[model samples]
Target: MAQEVFWRRKTLREMNREEWESLCDGCALCCLHKVEDEDTQEVFYTTVVCHLLDMNSCQCTEYERRCQLVPSCIRLEPEDVETFDWLPITCSYRLIHEGKDLPEWHPLLTGERSSVQQANASVLSVYEVRDNEISEDQLIDFILDED
Candidate 1:
């Protein structure tokens, strides 16, 4: 019989560092800026992405120092799996945490990291501007049109 993959067999908290890191699908939607409504506390994604994100690659240019550079950056940890509802619906981490299977275009499934961008599901196709190009107050103007 064939063996099940680590992602299907292990919980997010059970995976080793390498396994956990490999779970990321590189969609880079997480790199986009978000705003929370002060009253209802609803989170809204903005089209403005982090200045450190490489538009072409959809990866952070300063991955190691991301939190230090961006004070609002939320570092994903296995312990926070239950709180991943704020993540994008297409996010791998959120999908796995919710007991959903990886999408067909996931690197682990397609064996091609570029499949995400090729599918046009990445932030590359939606982002309007980099955070550095706009003021904090302008983020609301870039809110994604969720339908």
Candidate 2:
């Protein structure tokens, strides 16, 4: 008998809540703010981080009440995977949705929680500004090329 690798065997929509939550690599790129071009719909990543994001831990400071605290915050559901294009390319949800495997540095693969950071896939360095400190007009100044 062998243990089943749940992620490879199941679709995102087929997973239970625990399985779904476990998919997060915790790189926290999703917590960064983005700017979208109205005409082209091009989404640009920015250096600004959500107010609820803890700079040290890279976890939300108010995970449960995030929706209430920030209405624009996207609550990524399994069904929303395909539509959430703003998700970083390194994100587990986006990778799985695109029929790709998780990267070597993903915590699940490396068995080390800090692997994502070690791989330089996290937002720690880029996320120098907080969302509350910047205006929409200033977002362009912080646009960053995907790492």
Local error of candidate 1 at residue 58 (angstroms): 1.3
Over the stretch 87-130, how does candidate 2's per-residue lDDT look in tens digits? 88878998888888889898888899888888878888678789
Which candidate number has the best TM-score? 1
TM-score of 1: 0.96
Task: List the candidate 1 regions with Cα displacement exceeding 4 Å.
Answer: none
Model 1 residue 124 lDDT?
94
Q: Which regions of candidate 2 are displaced past 4 Å?
A: 1-4
Q: What is the model-wide C-alpha lDDT for candidate 2?
A: 0.85
Which run of 10 residues does model 2 get worst, by summed lDDT?
A: 78-87
Task: Report the poorest 10 consecutive residues by lDDT, candidate 1.
Answer: 53-62
| Clashing residue pairs, backbone N/CA/C < 3 A, model 1 | none
